[model samples]
Target: MEAARLAPEDVLPASEGITPAWPGRSVAVDGANIHVRDTPGRSATVEPAVYVHGLGGSSLNWTDLAGLLADYLDGQAIDLPGFGRSDPARSYTVTAFADRVIRWIEHSDRGPVHLFGNSLGGAVAVCVAGTRPELLRSLTLVSPAMPFLDPRRSFHGRLLPLLLIPRADWLAARRLAAIDPADLARMVIESCFADPSRFPEQRFAEAVEEARLRYTVPEYTSAYVRTLRSLILSFVRAYLPGSASLWQVARRISTPTLVIGGQRDMLVDVRVAAQVARTIPDSRLLTLHDVGHVAQMEAPRMVARAVLGMLSEASSVKLVPRTGASERPKRARRNTKSKRDIPFGGGITPAGEAAG
Candidate 1:
């Protein structure tokens, strides 16, 4: 039996209503309530894929890309504990989060999913893929928060370490409290994208609404701060050998992998994208010129196309070269004239030397 393929219109209807095609539900798995955005695929027998969002993000982050790729994959995007609608966990750590995902995969009886993650989730996905290779068919990471010692590349890179300070949560909450949800949304868009103007207004509005709603959650600030601290800690541990090392995890991963990075990302360094690609065996790196940290949000169709291509290709693993960027998907390059050479903030160009 073969899987049914989906078209973009099926998931991305032209309507302007709030829900659109992607809808989410809370599911109890392994004693944890996980918020998963559900999008039915073209066929029932098709294999399932799961998406994990970055720190402070929810399943909503995967909406556009998941919708765009729904034609080819029966997808679900998980909001890690303490994010979205999920209940808070006793402890928040990359390993703990990855364990929750692994347990869900095992409990759901969903074998070897096409795993997708961005930023912190990407780091968790790497841990999962490296530790339990049996649970994944393929892995896709969009700006995975791999280790980079230089803090100058991004504001978050510099800020992450400081989050370990005493009462960092209170400080962060105080900082966030002064900004309106809409303004916060704009700041996030500006920080995450090469060109904030490219973001869809409808989606932008939804994001603002979500931001407003998110503020109401009592655990929001604590979760954000704690997760940021844990993520920074993960970067520190990534240098060590054995299970603690993300590099070790990358090297141990046997599954085929696809890594995506943006040239103008203001969070994770773009150069880390290529470094991660080189670390994982049988993986390829795709660098989107003039794009930002959140490539899936910035260019959904393009990201979806890249994901679908990686999934559709033969299962055989191959070594992609470390030099130069992976070719941009043809569909993504159509409107080159509209894209500007956006400048990166917080001196994020050190990776540019590595990229060269």
Candidate 2:
């Protein structure tokens, strides 16, 4: 679980005002322009990992974690359609998003990849693994947006209650557009972090500026609304022909999987992580106490260590057995150490002890 020592040249400063430190370049995927963070210097033998961000998040979200793993993994993070610099597609369905990722992987001709996703992206990764397991070598999900009835834990859960009326999205967009960017940024940080202080000041300022820029885009609000609607629809589409419930899809996945959850996560309930781990037959769960919704952003070193640890043991990592309805996942012992390298199996033990 040691953090990779990123060299001075390997690290890029946070971009002026808007962009985060991650390096991005536009590339077409599934006939749509995709802005991706393509980190350099991966060994030829190591399998590349593709990162997918959550709703409203761009590939820039993966910057710190991607850099930490760059030595061991050829990492690239995608700005899903309608997010980041990518143009919104006509359809923003979860399946459509998953298909684009699958197509991109296929186009790379790099064979199966180690896929990592956060929140909404995690759910999308599950779709990809269930439908096209052949394209993935492994799967890592951080607080995936699994179906939950609790409004406190899900955007759809809350949105559904208000969207029974027509044009709800249109109305929601107008309200969202009225929010000041700086206020919106602070709100996001409050919602996502267990301790807002964990985020660096420079990055926070950049994020606020980025939020301001996003608010000014003519298509951003509509894109946000459309994507949010699609996300909600995916959870209830089990009745659709050829569609499967997230639980059902989880059962169909054979790829090695890692599920990470933050105990204090406000968005995706941490208790749900155990169910997700149990449902995905070949999966392991790591629950970090006191961490929030965005563990990668709030606890990048721990995430980097867990992911690298998972990759290092890709062939031998054993899956935890499905727990009973009341059984809970093991919680890791919290650590208070600052950013530094630890051993390969640093944070998590073979017995599911979570490192703080």
Candidate 3:
């Protein structure tokens, strides 16, 4: 079956009142202090959901969307090691990030929870879902940094050459130090949002504050550089035929998936969005026009509505637990009605063709 495409008007707008970042605390996982922002669900019956941010992004990125989904999800946005308030880790590889997430979920005993990731985090989430399908009830990727060989497609392309320069991290740090945090924040807002003018002033202030804090962390620059380099290398590996690439991992994913992308995303091409849905066996696609890289931040209410619809559909099917590493979870009979049958604030029109 083809993936459904949601129209701009079909999505609801976020609440007018902005909420502060969710309450956060440090949790020890695998000998590392991982910071997490916790959003209390409206009811005890709500399922657990974990949100992961992209490279150079912090847990604060998820504040609005987590709050909006509070009724159905007990959400926790995690600051991957070296980002946000989290302590630095020895390694910044995607696999390492995925390992930390796995340990946290195991430590919290929150297996089979809903998982969401944006950009780099989307790649990490893909790693987790592919290797440990038993750990996720569903997967949602927002503008995932999939392997795209064309460097011209994203702003990130400019930095790829830096990976070859010796002590590039130090050079990058010195360069960033020259820019004011407020200016850095503005750059981010401009890059991530199709309409930067539409961003709330208060939110921009918060972003500036977060950027200032990140600068104080000694490992911030190195972490960012290493992670970016690693991600690009992974992309290169993904292109090699017959290799165990992310695309290969994505095909193995069995969890229900939702892939969201902004039409104007400057970092990840919007065309890649449809390709992602087509890659995953049980996945849907959402491409929002006029939106940018951070759809969750740019269109939280719309993201929330699509998420709720997926959750509604997932609830109808029963999942059997995996008894061994080699065993795939058994899925019970799914409802005859398509996921579109589950209302998402309004009617939706299937793109009428397979995702590209």
Candidate 4:
């Protein structure tokens, strides 16, 4: 197997203007109203792709990436229950989140679609790929929030202790409520982006607006806090020697997968990126320097190029299996050199070559 490389044609032009968030509408799936921002493909023949954002992120997170991929994919970025304009869900567990995504795909009759996830969404995508292999054409994970014990970032370390307290979600919400929406948005941008200056002013304003709207939603802060707590619990379960660990789930996934990570990520350790690629049976990894947790947002064009490369390979080989099939789907040839480290502004290493 060869490493996935970005071709000259795959590089998005720098002159391409940033697209605003696609128009969103509510769709009911299993009694839950999911808000989805739809980006129509360049043609009806283009395949479908679904994007799921990380914890505390909404469908808007995929605005740029989805827009860039619209020529090849009809994309839908969904706001999970209790986020964006969606109603609160009864549960916030990772399994519950995966179930929602599965239901949405089934309800929309869009099986065997390209599934893309970031952070928490990546974990949810892992469950979906493992449990319902036939529902995905391929899986792309961006800095997935897999269970890691070492909280290198101060923010994560501070938040971990709060999970031990009773009614911590309420307490956290109360504290968050005291902060200004703009300040909160700024903090998020600072934490998520390796270079905060790269964030567009328009997007920053939209994030501020979203933060203010969140304050109006009664369940907003609680949803964020509880979801974080659930994710932390999942980390515990993943580390324990058990069949239910996320690593085990990754091992079971047969879909062609692309795992992208940020070398300078303040949250997830970059070394884990290689482990993720090695764990997934048919996977490739890309590590980008000078980027942080939200690589999809920080480097949409580069992300889009890698995604297109994967899609090209998947389509050329017709790797997607029929829905509801019992047999394991065909796997792509395993890449001997599964990981590639891309410099912030430099040439890429060729496929199957190790980057120094």
Candidate 5:
């Protein structure tokens, strides 16, 4: 028997008066909490931009990019359901993640704004575009984890499969906490950055601190476990050879898209970067050399450019690339003339380059 199919409207309920407007606060939706941070652009006409972080990551991951893009329009970022300062969701799935995003879209003061996501967040963005095209102006994905287990060119991510077991969570959680600061720091330096030398010491400290804080939470173990289970199940279902893959949804996405990845991404193979571009009819790819899994961290300007480009395209605006993208004004009134661009590329462009 087939699993189930959900309509766009069925998944996204109208969340009127449900989610509050908070620049850097938590909001409730569908009984689940999500962290939201909004920055108004310089212009009243430009639409708002929504940013989503990956698994175990919060809206904080997008802080640098969000601040720059928010300057482009009414800008924003989210913690998804479970990972950040906000409380975990009652249920979790790619569809559920999409639902939270859609409901937020329905509730926003800005209509059909630009949507940006990274890794897991990238997958959610794709699902939202496929499931509810009407709610999106464009899509910008940063090293989205849409590809299945590529036995070659990947290792640490193999850790995800072990997630099928509950015990693994305990061990992983324990290990995360018990590891020496120097060793943990080494992992961060190796896994997170293309140039470990450049990372600000305080910033890395905050990430480690946040990870430590999560380790102390009671639900942290279970939430991480269930989150892993969901991924394993989704992966199994999406990769049944003859069945649909995440790329299947990408193909049906009518919205314009920009897909990007880092040359040094170890978790999700950068090879899948072009898959999104090939599958999404109107998509592009930007692969930055010497970067890692966290594009927003390693290259915020590049991520911002892709998002702002897509937003401009969706709003039908003729944009001046590079520097102008940084100038997006705050939320005001919609201008009939131009919009922000949606640029998620599959190949490496400079930090903020636009393609034809």
Candidate 6:
């Protein structure tokens, strides 16, 4: 892959004190060695957590959230096949990654787990939940990829050419390499943050390091292109009659769910994440106004609170289906009332609840 990467001399760690902690083990998935980080001791709790990361991210990406998550449900984070230290695989797709995830679960102490996913992983978790609801207690999706109602809005959607066009992929990668790695990394970081100043310089440096490694690695360009292409393809065809967008699938999800979205995300619109919550009967949604893309990284404490909040709600919600007789016949027998608060103000619902 062609990469605009930074050299070791010109680029340095973002902060002097920051240390990216990576502690874990190795497992096998689809014949590829998978790296894992487990919270000590078997979880003597109700929830067994398994986290999945976004495109171009690995298990290490969840470093910030692990300790907080462990305080809730002692769990581990594992690298998906062909990412991180894991050996490159035959293919990278939702199904392929899901299969690997299922294998990991089977061999883990956390099968039938509560899953957490961000971006690309969020989509995978949703697909897996569709086929194996029994294996999942609930799902927590952070800014999952959704179908574009307006293709022109998202930067990634509009930048699709960087991956789709022939040879452009190579050219971009090469250009990326020639440019200062730290500078390119900053561009990416700044683009994602609501307030770029809030971005951790240390984390940005780590990103640069990762970029350099990815660029130097053979087939990295192809892998990056393929990953981006697959992401777009999945979003475009998320749902039909049989297979719908993951958001659509979320509506049918019987498992308790929490949908977290970044209000300022330039890539995946916040509106879609709200839709994901609305579609699911047992789901609650939280919109982080200042964070983008990777919320846990951007605001770890808030993300932790949200995750814990969802778990608390999930614990109280019984999985039993809601059943009731149709009230439409009786509704026609009674008079209906409606009121409007007027434009530039608010409105009252038919049920009399005021909405602003």
Candidate 5, residue 198: CA error in Å? 3.0
Candidate 4: count the clashes. Answer: 0
Model 2 off-target regions past 4 Å? 1-20, 42-44, 155-158, 238-243, 316-356
Residue range 1-356, candidate 6, lDDT tens digits:
01011112111111122325546678765566888876542123435788888777777667666654553455667776656666666777677777777878887756678888888888888777877788887788888875665766676766675765788658767876787767767776766665565555556666788666766666565556677777677666765554556656665678877777777887777677767667767766666655688776666545665566556555632122113223111111112111110111211011121110
Model 4 has an lDDT value of: 0.79
Q: Which ten residues in a row have the lowest lDDT in candidate 5?
A: 1-10
Note the Cα lDDT for every prediction shown. 0.74, 0.71, 0.80, 0.79, 0.65, 0.63
The most accurate candidate by TM-score is 4
> Which candidate number would show the highest lDDT if scored against the true structure?
3
* Tens-digit lDDT track of model 4 for 1-356: 23555634423433234466688999877676899999887544678899999888999999888876765788989998899899898899889999999998998897779999998899999999988999999999998888787775435767887888898878877887999999999988898888787777778878999889888998987788888888888888998998789989989999999888887777676666667788898887777777888988887767888887787776642222223322322223222221112234643334555122
The list of candidate 4 runs beyond 4 A from truth reads 10-14, 316-344, 347-356
- Candidate 3 collision pairs: none
Pick by TM-score: 2 or 4, better one: 4
Comparing 2 and 6 by TM-score, which wins? 2
What would the per-residue lDDT of candidate 1 be over residues 1-356, giving only the tens digit for each residue? 01112122222322222225366788888666888888676434456788999988888888767755554578888889999888889778989999988987887677779999999999999999999999999999999988887788876865765586898887877878889999999888888888888766667877898789777887788888888887777778877665778888789998988888888888987689988887887876667776888888776655665565566563532212223223211122122221222322432223233233
**Per-candidate clash tally:** 1, 7, 0, 0, 34, 15
How well does candidate 3 score on lDDT at residue 317? 28
How high a TM-score does candidate 2 get?
0.80
Q: Which has the higher TM-score value, candidate number 1 or candidate number 3?
A: 3
TM-score (all chains, Cα) for each model: 0.82, 0.80, 0.87, 0.88, 0.78, 0.77
- Compared with the true structure, model 6 gives a TM-score of 0.77
Candidate 3 wrong stretches, greater than 4 Å: 5-16, 316-356
Question: Comparing candidate 2 with candidate 5, which one achieves the higher TM-score?
Answer: 2
Candidate 5 C-alpha lDDT tens digits along 185-214: 567557666666545554566567666667
